[model samples]
Target: MKKSNQQLTTIKTLFLGLMVLILTSFSEVAAQNDPVRLGFIPLTDCSPIVMAKELGLFKKYGVEVVVTKESSWANIRDKVLTGELDGAHCLYSMPFSVYTGVGGKAGSEMMIAMMLNVNGQAITLSNDFCGKVGFKQMNKVTPVVAAKLKAEKEVTFAMTFPGGTHDLWLRNWMSIAGLNQKAVKIITIPPPQMVANMKVGNMDGYCVGEPWGGVAVKQGIGFTQIASQDIWKDHPEKALVVNKEFSEKRRTDLVKVMKAIMEACIWLDNPANRKKAAAIIGKAPYVNAPADVIENRLMGNYDLGCNQGTEVYSNDYMLFHKGGMVNYPRKSYAIWAMAQYVRFGYLKEAPNYKAIADKLILQDLYEEVAKSMKVKVPNDDMKPFSLTMDKTVFDPNNPAAYLKVVKR
Candidate 1:
């Protein structure tokens, strides 16, 4: 009996040891696949990153992702530049700006793994101005007419950042309307505060990304003068930005991050997910607006906030899913943004825009990630598309001439 009891004790101890070994192995694997932190601003189009985390797509691909909400684009740029962040959902032009040293302390080679979204922005005019101008929709009135009417008035307009996409869009929209940028007082305001500032009569008009513009309309503070899609169809808006050094050192991890986001973008673009995405984004911590306000527009329903009734716009607002169009990073998209930079005096000369775009966009990396995930990448990553304002086709092969024609 004593021998049998001793044998039993030895067996129990061995079983316990084996259990510990298995547990330790799992813990190590989990640690190895720990989340890569991603930074983003609080914009509706930031859905892919947000939805990826919410839906567990990141985990499904053996990645742990933590999404950090940043207050401003500058914060997003600075954090990524200083290595405080692994990557970010950033302005499409931000990587170019950082690489060329145009904004935020110069000479940082910020690279974009993919263009995450496009064309879901708007220019809003205050309701007070609507009453004064006697126009039902500010967007319908030509900028030349608007400027002539408000020439004597200050006609203050605001953009989210000085050297950001919002600024360029606002300037381009005004120029197309025949408003001299120098004549109108252009101010910079953080996007989140846009609606509130306009409500308090601090500004007459503003151009900003969605949810904010939708929120402004929802609050009866402003009306949509123009959807950004009208200014440029499927214009590149935001991207996943990282420092070139980090990308080089952590290439595998970078590819994983891009893959995860690409999956999230796919999920977001689904028509069925629109309501759910708006509900998810409308939470106080995200967009901080009514779900209806976000959902209707997110699904391409636009009201313009003057009770003009909602209209179904096309797929101008993108979250990257659908037919493989979103993940393919285009060098032409980056170069077009650079052209705008030069047009607006943010860049003195072209600054080798093509070379810089090629360096930062990483189309090859995007293709590899798509292939590994069995996602189809478009054969032509870059295509020529014309904008309505100048009716100029942006040929990637002839960017210099394209710029010259646009300037003329």
Candidate 2:
């Protein structure tokens, strides 16, 4: 009987060990299978999404992320709103526009977890138009010359989307050139079709993100009239945007997504890894353009193709890894875009722009995500930045004054 009791005890211990192992395995499987879906437009700025997937950053953070390539910004916004996409590599103004019920169907509120990239957008003018305007070089052409030429003809300007960052940049560029946007015909052309549209003379100029701009200049169909960086240095371009409902329901998952993106951003910014990044972006599925076209601009070396000159510009065209400050969603950055929206009449009037910016930008969420990853956050992410043309200083603290100054 004592021998029988000993065997039963051993069997009992074995059962407990098996149960513990099963529980641990179940926990691991649960962590591995938690789904996080992210959407992206096939632009160069979508590097964060690609890099995160390639580098396994999502898995490192206990997330199984699926990054979907969206056809258009409209699709991205709509899918995210209707629960088709958990988040997306979105236009900087997308969250704000949706929140304010401006872009798509009304009453859709969106939120951005972080800013993904700055600069790297360009305004491309067709070679035919450049010849007609008698502008051999983009930099040599003055705003006055552009305006004079524009007045002589009904110049059609194209942007990727209405109420997008590209649209705002295009409008702001025209405004600075003293050209009335209403006087010029403006149309929406998808970024992928920008080159084809310009080739067919459908548009005289277009403001779009790379590698379409680079592709246009490379294909000899158009010339880079102005790099958006020239207009606003390190301008906010894209962000990781999601609907408010997603943020509320999956707060932890959303934060994890932000953290993974932040890590990918850091990885992409590393100078040593730029060549790899260029090659990665050049793949058929992502930017799907020539490796050299993506490589040159990714390295800050630009060939405008309109002029016989090439130069190394600033590292203003950013992706991912610009150290600590680049990934943080600054309130001022959001407000700056809103100010441009107001400047160009996209917004009827600035309505508590900062408060609206605060609601969409999600600086508090960015900080939490960065802190969780042990990434250092900048103390003054939101600060004053003056533009070269108007010499207007935008103060995040005093947004009303900033708007008033812009209006004046």
Candidate 3:
């Protein structure tokens, strides 16, 4: 009887061990299959992530994604750094800014997985300057600003974030138009709050991504002064930014997500599908704006208020995938953005542009994903490009020389 009991106890131990192993394996698999959480600020540029989830592209690519609508850019940066978010629809210059300590902690690593979309951002001015400055007539604003400064009234302007794309655009406009940056107060305002702040006469102007620009015009508080593309035709605006750990550890899953977003980008570029996309992203959970407001600018139709009449941008509207050109992460673009930081006094000195660009931008991974998707990558790195507004040529190969010649 003693021998029989010992054998039964050994058998029970073996069974329990086997069950533990099985449970552990199941838990590991479940953990690996957990959903990737992505965050986005409610703007039209966030369409790629939204479309990816809504169109079931995430599942099609064999990954789960939870899209969170963040309230501000600072929140997006914090959550991404803490691993609370896997990735985000972020400003193209945000990671660089954070890494360099212009926007966040210096030396923080945020990787640019790929470019999400270009253009579709704008600078809106209050009705105070509506009659003074019309679309693309940024030169005319200098006089009004001078008048304001002469009157001892603070000439306040706002951008979505410091050292961000909108900030650079607003600064560039001010520089070219000869407006004194020091004389004007440039504050940071969240994209959604731009129109509301303008409504209360809090700011003279703001630079932000759509559909807020559209929203501002719709509310009759402001007028579209200039589209971002007009500043630099097809300029890089937003990106798919991921944490360093997520990019390194979950590389395959990141590739899947990139592929899915790229597919959504292709879909978004299709002119016929934009109306549907606008309707979907404009919902409360996404951009939370009027569908018509989002759709108008998405289709390249701008109802520029202040009697400027409507203008159609046939070629330079918000581009998601223009034959895959818009999706390629160009290091030259990053170089230009960082150079602008120095040019506008955001950075005290120039950064190691090539090293920073190569480190932060995951070109190899983007190439891998692009090749898998049969997408053509553009070979336009380290080349000189000109802005449409000022015709200032930026030669990425020699950023220092370009910086020397450009007027601040």
The TM-score of candidate 2 is: 0.85
CA displacement after TM-score superposition, residue 64 of candidate 3 (Å): 0.7
lDDT per residue as tens, model 1, 32-109: 565677888888888888888888777777767788888888888888888788788888887777666666666677
Better of 1 and 3 by lDDT: 3
Instruction: Identify the candidate with maximal TM-score.
Output: 3
Ranking according to TM-score, highest score first: 3, 1, 2
Write down the worst ten-residue block by lDDT for model 2: 132-141
Please list the residue runs of candidate 3 whose C-alpha ends up more than 4 Å from where it truly belongs after superposition.
Answer: 1-30
Flag the better candidate by TM-score, 2 or 3.
3
Looking at model 3, which ten-residue stretch has the lowest summed lDDT? 25-34
Residue pairs whose backbone atoms clash in candidate 1: 35-64, 143-177, 144-177
lDDT of every predicted structure (CA atoms) = 0.77, 0.77, 0.92
